[model samples]
Target chain A: MNIKNSNIIVLVSSILLVVGFIISIVNTMVLVSPTEHIEGSWKEISWEYEKTESGNTNKKISDAIKTEICKELIIHEAEVWNFLAGGNLELTSNTNNETLSWTMKGRGNILELSHKTNKIEHYNIQILNNDKMVLYFSTDIQAKGIVKMTFEKIKEDSYAQKI
Target chain B: MLRKFSNSRTLKDNIQLGALSAFSAGMVNVTSLIIFFAFTSNVTGHYAILAEEISKGNWYQASVVFAWIFMFFIGNFISNIIIINFNHKNAYAAHSAPLIIEIICLLAVGYYGHFYYRETLSETEIMVGTMLFAMGIQNGLTASISNFSVKTTHLTGLTTDVGILTAMFTKKKYRQNKQLRSKFNVLLAIAAAYLAGGIVAGVIYYEAKFLVFFAVSAVIGFIILYEYYKLKVTKYIRIKRTIKLRKGILETT
Candidate 1:
């Protein structure tokens, strides 16, 4: 390896690194806009809470408690959230429906859902794509930890049929 | 240690490089696991996940895993490319360049995690990928410069080597082999250091959080600076010896 070759290699590595950094930033900007991808109806696919116990151990909550929590959150089986264009979010399940206002902040990563009583809930958007959205939030209630909720976009035809 | 290739590296050099890099690798691996729910140092589990995701037809997850693997691969590739191209002109510089990059990556992760990280999946994924690349660079440089004798990121191979050597030691002839003993020592040092690093990081993470990365970077920086200091000392001694010899000749003449 000569000096010239070494210089070239260093230059190339630096360029590649800069390019990679740029691409990563650009990809985040272009591929992850919550407002655009988050609109429309979404069905809850799964929800999980990871609790940190002693020794930094992580344990998932029991099924019964998980079910209760899900029920409390109005996210029972086949629960859906219809995110309308004008900041309206409609949460519906088999037996219940509720409407909430939603706004995104922090580069479309922080989702703030507001109720009529002026209560606001914030969820960090883990992932938001055309077909799926994963949101995460922390809770200090029973089995305190972070909760991750995954949702799949409900296709227009299926949503129409359900309506 | 800085300029010597693997065939020429002493047992001391091998142990020093292996242990320090392994320690940092362990810290990065454990810290990323604790914070991001991902492992950044090694790709074996990621490969398995990739396979599983592919089998399950989860393209998104499979692709993410694939990208992680690729980032690790590129880290190795870039490090080796730097080394092979520049080992002749300035072996130390060639070797240190990758560590510099690794340090930068770890620092970025640490700073962002401490101040700006929102604990989002995107943030986690990007940070993990950055760490994987950093680890790859480290693994590549150590292995390449040491003539493939040192791999600090993962212990599966080292553990296997140790197992084989231990089994061989059951024979008297193998016990008499100095090379085998040296290899065993290097492996043991790396394994112990890796475990120690992980334990330290785990304990410190409770208090320092992402600032643990700064500690890891300092460890790596010590490795590079120590070598540079050694190089300078060696050069200074050589200059002093040459001057003494010249003075002696002048007096005699």
Candidate 2:
């Protein structure tokens, strides 16, 4: 290819890349909100604790209290959290069911889930996409650590429903 | 290898450039994956993630992915800029500039990750971005200096080329084509070297962790030093031959 044509190709690709980047930023700022994206049924896939102690770190849920909490909150069969519209979150599992108030704070990075007994828990939104959400929160029960929970959105097959 | 102008480069030069750069790229990619859970040497998966994030309205993630892509693009742009602007004056300096930059980036990552990195999300993002930029420089330099014959940072295109060449070789005429065979060899060498580098990196990372970046830098450094050594050796041979001819003329006089 001629130099001029090659330059044009590079210019066009660069422009497209810059334009796409700007559009992504603008879209994030104006078109979508965390609350809107978080409103769905999601199943718990996995959870782990990132434990940091004296400059050494390991990611595992080893503390007894943390393990018990995981069992109570996540390990049951068919554990799912359904974030509904109008600021309500419904958590369901084989042994328990509860409804809570959910709100996104800190520009959609902090997810606040308020329980019925007025206990409020905050999870940092590590990742929140359409199909997956990863939430994390620090704990000091056993050691200075962070707990990360990964959830996958449970997609209901509308076509299969019709069938 | 020091000859910056693509047409002057030999097949051996192309092989050395392709194999070393591809190996370092592979090491960088795998090491980044192990540390940051992100691919650094290639943007194909990042592009897909960008599209996915945009489609899903995860604008934050979309922007992050876009920024990563932009860094890679900027690295390529900077590398080519250095080459096209200075290649006329000093081919070796111009070509080595990008690899030097890549080495610095890798070393910085290695140092910061080993001593200071806290495994935070921000740290991961920045480290991954730095790696992508370094790989971009490498990819740009190899492709530019080889007349676009060798691109080492990503194997998707190289793999496609190899596949096409292999299929073409089924024809008797294509089998006899020297250029096609040479191209196939370069691609295969690059692919094999990339895989081998990744395997070595994986094992090193298991024992040494972030110091794997140092090993990658050493590989790139070797490429530069090897070329310089060859240049010096050839100059010495020519000088020796000229001196011997002068001695012969003196005796004849």
State which candidate has the highest lDDT: 1
Candidate 1 residue-wise lDDT, B145-229, digit = tens: 8888999987889889999999999999999999999999999999999999999999999899999999999999999999999
In model 2, state the lDDT of residue A117. Answer: 71
How do all models score by TM-score?
0.68, 0.69
Over 4 Å off in model 2, which ranges? Answer: A1-163
**Where is the poorest 10-residue window by lDDT in model 2 chain B?**
B117-126
Clashing pairs in 2: none
| Model 2 error, position B91 (Å) | 0.6
Return the lDDT, model 2, position A136.
Answer: 89
lDDT of 2 by residue, B1-253 (tens): 7554688887888888899889999999989876666789999988897787778766666776787888898899899999999988988899999999999999999999999975444466677888989999988889999999999976889889988998999999999999999898889889999999999999999999999999999999998898888878988999999999999999999
- For model 1, what fraction of the real interface contacts is kept? 0.00
What C-alpha lDDT does candidate 2 achieve relative to the native structure? 0.81
